[model samples]
Target: MKSVHMDVHALLDAGVIERRAAGFILPYDAVHVDFFLKAG
Candidate 1:
C-alpha cells in the first residue's frame, strides 16, 4: 500500500491528478488510465 501511495503522490506531482479530502481526483479525462484508477 505504501508503493501505491508513492505512485499517487508521483501522479499528483506530475499534475496528472489532484488530492482531495476523499482522496485523489483526476482533473481531466484525456488519459485512459485515470478513469480506471479510483481514488480511495
Candidate 2:
C-alpha cells in the first residue's frame, strides 16, 4: 500500500489546506462550484 503522508504534507505546506484538532480542512469558509452538463 502507498502512504499518503508525503502528499498530504505537500498540500499542507502549500497552504491549500489546514489542519484541525480532528483532521484537515480545505481552508475555505464556503465553496462554490459550477457544473456544466451536456445532455444528449
Q: What RMSD does each model have against the real structure?
A: 8.0, 6.0
Tell me how far candidate 2 lies from the true structure as C-alpha RMSD in angstroms.
Answer: 6.0
Q: What is the C-alpha lDDT of each candidate?
A: 0.85, 0.83
| Pairs that clash in candidate 2 | none
Q: Rate residue 12 of model 1 by lDDT.
A: 87
Please provide, for model 2 over 1-40, each residue's C-alpha lDDT reduced to its tens digit, 9 standing for 90 to 100.
Answer: 1458888888799887789998999978886668899989
Model 2 — TM-score against the truth?
0.57
TM-scores of the models, in the order given? 0.61, 0.57
lDDT by residue for model 1 (1-40), tens: 9999899989888998998899779888678653456689
Worst 10 residues of 1 by lDDT: 29-38
